[model samples]
Target: MPDLRLSRRRVLALSAVATLLPRSGLGQTSKVARIGLVQSTTGGSAALYGTEQKQAIELAFNEITKARTLGDIALQAFHADDGADRGQTVNIFQRLIRQDKVVAILGPTLSNSAFAADPLAQQAGIPVIASSNTAPNLTKIGDFIFRTSVPEDQVFPTVLAYGVRKHGVKRVALIYGIDDALTRSAHDVQKKAVDALGLESVGIETYQRGDVDFSAQLTKIKAQKPDAIILGALAEEGAAILRQARQLNLDPKTVFIGCNANISAKLFELAGPAADGILVGASWFAGYDTPRSKAFVEAYRKRYGTTPDIYAAQGYDAAYLIAEAIRRAGTATDSRAIRDKLAGITDFEGVLGRFGWSPERDATVTPKVLIGDGQAKVFAAAPAV
Candidate 1:
């Protein structure tokens, strides 16, 4: 409950010159601006995430348009399904830039898809606000690339620290999908945290993205008898790993931890009783008591008949972020103006709390650590030392 509001210094200043510049030659002739939404709505790994992201983007865009926030300019959305294929993602991105003439794009859900697709958008001079790509090196792709979701570096260590201090976790086991760039990056981050905290890494294991059998990895993890197990896989895989580990006599006392991937209500339903003690790090949860957050949650539930997950929350923020940039630029058609506006974004608050872009083009935001019982509820902030 400490003062989490952004300070005045963090607010971006719009200079008189940038504000007064003439838009006559900046492709401002159009009365409507188009934003392309790229998501993998048909593929196995990303279908659920993509559906949620699309819904959230549409909700935010509708809200903005209904408020007439952009005056006479109409905001239109163009959606393309990536199908969870990197090649398809690249192709669709090119189409969005060349054919639809979208000023900005909201997603390509998977981090690997972003790695493949965002470069094309960057080279084409179109800004992309990645809704759910959390791997390292994403923002480092280029100045045009930005992500709304908190990265593993921002999420992991606190959860690890909590495990060590609150749950008495010392020795740890790590498991992740080696085939996935995002999961691999998460595993690397967890390893670094273990080294930094002087915690023993008892066992490290890897699995393929679609593989169901994890007996080999679980058996290895069981032999380690580590104090905690950290998983960098998505919800389905992570839940299965937890269940298999428990069945293999892995200690129930051993804490189970995951990153943003496990921040879904589906995990509890999927993993059943095995998911009782899991801890997940996240950016937004429906349990936030703020008026804005409560309203968003209520609206989302009314529309979708379910609680919004992190992917949905990030997608909503990304849409508003793009809309804010376009509004400041005075025209959505000017790529340079929009890019500049995006970089100067500061103190924009949303369902996720204070949102701003760091100089590196990464989102500068803190994460909340939530422990999943039947739901992922906020773990009370650790008392100050």
Candidate 2:
């Protein structure tokens, strides 16, 4: 069993529990564990991701509560909007722990905010199930922090190698959001993959997170005339880059490859024709035919009337994963016990295959290569073959 004791300072930070009511003929009242869901509902470029994540969390929680799988504890979830802002992320982290006394927190969407806000939860000795922060260093924040996303280091290389072999890609150009932590980290991983695979480096260009115009960067990339363009950014910027690449008359035959962020169906809608044939790496897609995947998709569609992408799938898995932690601990009242239980979980399969924690406390599952053709289609990469 993992350690369940918090530091002396952390134990001191915990608020005194109110006295329980004396047992009557009606029996002792059941305690409800409040789980705080912090997400980017209103602002930021990843708001769509946040919406899907929130819906999935709610859906999973409802299913678990209906099944009564968590024993005597009834569960309630409260949501807070971080708006994808770092300051707002910190504010909500404090509020969720102090006021709500939440057993755990779900997400704040982006890696940038996670880098800033996760430390607060770690200090409070609260376990956080990161729904979609894929940056490699996230779990290093503390023992209490965990994520459902496989790091870019584990995901990108295999996917990129497949794209290279399948599409006959030799020379590759790179574009990433310099300001965003996830994109910047992804760019580094892409570089390593390109080098390890012996692919030519044509050019590397970058933009700030909110920049719209990419003609200058695209033109520079166009000059290199690479066989593939690698995008290490979120959907909004990735879509914009594709649209701009098309407008600039960059070679139609040149393939566009993106990180996990490009797996969303909305990217297809945003970029329209430009999104077609774009390749991405993801741990979950709506098209997976497994029984668990099918059931999750059906429940999500019935509840929200929309097909969930990887973000939503991960968020749903995060809810159940935390609930399982509480169940395994035999008590939802103690945050330290829940953290220990989560750390002990291994080889649990959800919609994602073989879900478990790596030695660093991040997700250990590998992603499957997916191609966008109006929707994501499963593709086997050559390296995996």
TM-score against truth, every candidate: 0.89, 0.89
Backbone clash pairs for candidate 1 read none
Candidate 2 Cα deviation (angstroms), residue 49: 1.0
For candidate 1, write residues 1-385 as lDDT tens digits: 5322112101211121122223331244346677778876777757768878987887887777667778767676777677788887887787778877888888998898999889988898899998788898798888999888888888899888988888888899999999988899999998999999999999999999798989998888888899999998987788788788878877779999887777766676678778877877777777777777788889888888988877888888898899899999999689878988988989988888887987777788778777776444323233332
Local distance difference test, each candidate? 0.79, 0.81
Tell me how candidate 1 scores on lDDT.
Answer: 0.79
Residues 89-201 of candidate 2 have per-residue lDDT tens digits of 88778877897788898997989899998999999999998878888788899999999977778888978888877889999999999988889999999999999999999
